[model samples]
Target: MTQSEFVNLVMPFKDKLYRLAKRLLVSTEEAEDATQEVLMKLWDKKKGIGSYRNVEAFAMTMTKNFCLDRLKSKQSGNLKLVHSNYADDRTSLQKEVELNDSLEWVGRIMEGLPEQQKLVLQLRDVEQYDYDEISEMLDMKPTAVRVALSRARKAVREQLIKKHSYGIQ
Candidate 1:
C-alpha cells in the first residue's frame, strides 16, 4: 500500500487503538507510545497489510497484545488499571461530580474483574465493538464474547447498586 492508502486505512481507527491501549496501560504517555509503535509496525508491514481480511481487528489485536505484554513486563510494576473516559460538557457541576464519582467507582470495580472480563467490557462497552469483532480480536467465540460482556456488565451493575444502596436503611 502507498503511504496515502496506509494513512487512509489506519487513521480512522487510530484513536480506538489509543483508547484500548490507555484502558490497558492506564498511562497516557505509555498509550501514546504504544499506539505509535503499533502504527509503525503496521506501516512497516504495509506491503502485505492488504492481504489481511480485517486490518482494524488485526491492529486492535496487536494493540491489545502489546499493552498486555507491557503490563507484564518488569518495568510495569507501577502501572495500574484505571479508566477515565467520562465527559459531559452540559451537566451541572454537582452532576458532573456525581458522574465522576460513579465512573470512578465503576473503574475500581472493573479493576477487580478478571483480565478477560475487563477486556470484554472495555471492547464492547467502552470501545463499542460488536460481538463478532470482539470475538476476532480476543480470539473468543461470539457467544463467549456475549457471555463475558453480560457477566462483566452484571458485575459492574451489582457492585454499583450495592455501593449506592449502602447505609440507606
Candidate 2:
C-alpha cells in the first residue's frame, strides 16, 4: 500500500485502537505505546491488510492480544484498570455528582470482572460491536460472545444492586 492509502485505511479507527488499548492497559502512556506498536505492525503488514474481510476486527484483535500480553508482563505491575463512561457537561451539579458516583462504581465493578468478561463487555457494550464482530475479534463463537456479554452485564447489575442495597463497597 502507498503511504497515503495506508494512512487513509488506518486513520479512521486509530482512536478506537487507542481507546481499546487504554481500556485494557489502564495507563495513558502504555496505551499510547500500545497504539503505536499496533499501528507500526499494521503499517508493516499493510500489503496483507487488504486481504482481511474486516481489517478493523483484525486490528482490534491485535490490540486486545497486545494489551493482554503487556498486562501479563512484569512491566505491568504498576498498571491499574480504571474507566469512566459518562459525561457531566449538560447536567446540574447534583445530577453530575450522582452520575460521577455511579460511573465510578461501574468502573470499579468492571475492574473486578475476569479478563475475558472485561474484554467482552468493553467490546460489545462500550465499543458497540455486534455479536458476530465481537466473536471475530475475540476468537469466540457468536453464541459464546453473547453468553459472556450477558454474564458480564448480569454481574455488573448484581454488584450494583448489592452495593446500593447493603451500602457495601
Candidate 3:
C-alpha cells in the first residue's frame, strides 16, 4: 500500500490503538511511544497490509502485544494502570462524590485482577469490543473470552461487596 492508503486505513483506529496502550501502560508518554512503534511496524509491513482481512483488528492485536511486552519489561517497574473514565457533571455533589469513590474502587479492583482478566475486561467493557473481536485480539476462543469476562466481572463485584460489607468475606 502507498503512504496515503496506509494513512487512510490506519487513521480511523489510531486513537483506539492509543487508548488500548494507555489502558495497559497507564502512562501517556509510554502509550504514545507504543502507538508510534505499532504504526512504524505496520508501515514497515505495508506491502502485505492488504492481505489482512481486518486491518484494524490486526493493528489492535499488534498494539495489545506491544503494550503487554512493555508491561513485562523491567522498564515498566514504576508504571501502574489507573483509569478514570467515569464522569457525570449534572449530578448532585453528593452523587458525584459517591460516583468518584466508586470509580476509584473500580480502578483499584481492576488493577488487582490477573492480566488475562484485566485485558478481557478492558477490551469488552471499556472498549466495547464484541466477544469475537476480543477473542481474536487476545488469541482466545470465543467461549473462553466470555468465561474470562464473566469471571473478571464476578471478581470485581465480589471485591466491591467485601469492601462495602466491612471486611466480611
Candidate 4:
C-alpha cells in the first residue's frame, strides 16, 4: 500500500484499536504506546499488509500479543512494575473512575476466559467484528464462532456471579 492509501485506510481505525488495547492493558499510557507501536508497525510494513486478508484483525492481534507479554512479565516477577503501570493518573482527569473500574473488571473477566473464548470475545465485542469476520480472522467456522461466544458469555456471567457472592474482595 502507498503511504497515502495506508494513512487513509487506517486513520479511522485508531479509536477502535486504542480502545481494544486499553481493554487489554487497563492503562491509558500503555494503551496509547501500544496503539502507536501497532500503527508504526503497520506503516513500517505497509508493503506486506496488502498480503493479509484483513489488516485490522492483524493489528488487533499485534496489540493483544503486546499486552499479553506485559501481563505475563508482570505476573512472573514484577509486582512493583505492574503496580506502577497504573500509578500515574492525574487527579483532574476527565474520565470517570467508575468507567475505568468497569473496564478493569471486564478486562479481568476477559483475561480469565479460555484462549479461544478471549480472542473471539475481543474480536466480536471489543473490536465489533461480526461472526463471519471473527470466523475469518480466527479461521473458525461462523457456527463455531457463535457457539464459542455463547459459551464464553455464560462463563463470564457465572464468574461474575461467584465474584459477587464472595463480595469480590
Using TM-score, give the best candidate's number. 2
Off by over 4 Å in 3: 75-100, 166-169
Error of 3 at 83 (Å): 15
- The sequence of per-residue lDDT tens digits that candidate 4 reaches over residues 1-169 is 6778988988887787787777666678988998999899889988888798888777766777776777677677655565554434322234323335655666666765766787777778767788877776667889999999999989989967865665545
Q: Considering lDDT, which of the candidate structures 3 and 4 is the better prediction for this target? A: 3
1-169: candidate 3 lDDT, tens digit per residue: 7889889999999999998887777678988999999999999999888899888899999999998898787345653322222223322345433544767768867766877888888898998998888989998999999999999999999978866774333
After aligning candidate 2 to the native by TM-score, how far in Å is the CA of 123 from where it should be?
1.1
Residue 112 error, candidate 2, Å: 1.5
The lDDT per prediction is: 0.82, 0.81, 0.81, 0.73
Clashing pairs in 4: none
What pairs collide in candidate 2? none
Score residue 10 of candidate 3 by CA lDDT: 93
After aligning candidate 3 to the native by TM-score, how far in Å is the CA of 123 from where it should be? Answer: 1.4
Weakest 10 consecutive residues of candidate 2 by summed lDDT: 81-90
Q: Candidate 1 residues 45-102, lDDT tens each?
A: 9888989999999999999999889878724564332232322322234553455566
TM-score of each: 0.80, 0.81, 0.78, 0.65
RMSD of 4: 6.4
TM-score of 1: 0.80
| Sort by TM-score, top down from the best | 2, 1, 3, 4
Q: Is candidate 1 or candidate 4 better by lDDT?
A: 1
